[model samples]
Target: MRVKVDADKCEGHNRCCALAPELFDVDDYGTATALNDGNVPPELEEKAKLAVQNCPEYAIEFVKD
Candidate 1:
């Protein structure tokens, strides 16, 4: 699985970063971006999913690889 962040939809809540820092990063303005181009390592899959679930803006999403 892979992760994707919709910058336009993101309200910079940082929930994705808070829940899965390994999968996301937040800018100084609090905009979130997926780490490593949103590639999810096998071990980090659950964390990635958790990040998506926790994003109040629903900006984080999972993509099939």
Candidate 2:
């Protein structure tokens, strides 16, 4: 599965990065950005979902492609 992060909804919380550093990147201001083009590896799928679930803004989502 793939994932995508909503830049508009991100509020620099960094929770996503804290949960899954490999899947996310934190900006200078602490906003989270998905890594690897948000293309989650199978082994890391659960971590990706956890990051999405823990985001306070609910800015992360699975992409259907």
Residue-pair clashes per prediction, in order, are 0, 0
Top candidate when judged by lDDT against the true structure: 1
lDDT of 2: 0.90
lDDT of each: 0.91, 0.90
* lDDT tens digits by residue: candidate 2, 1-65: 88899999999889889889999998897777889899998999999989989999999999997
Query: Where is model 2 poorest over a 10-residue stretch in terms of lDDT?
Result: 26-35
lDDT of 1: 0.91
User: Looking at model 1, which ten-residue stretch has the lowest summed lDDT?
Assistant: 56-65
**TM-score of candidate 1 against the unseen true structure:** 0.94
Per-residue error (Å), model 2, residue 40? 0.4
Clashes of 1: 0
TM-score against truth, every candidate: 0.94, 0.94
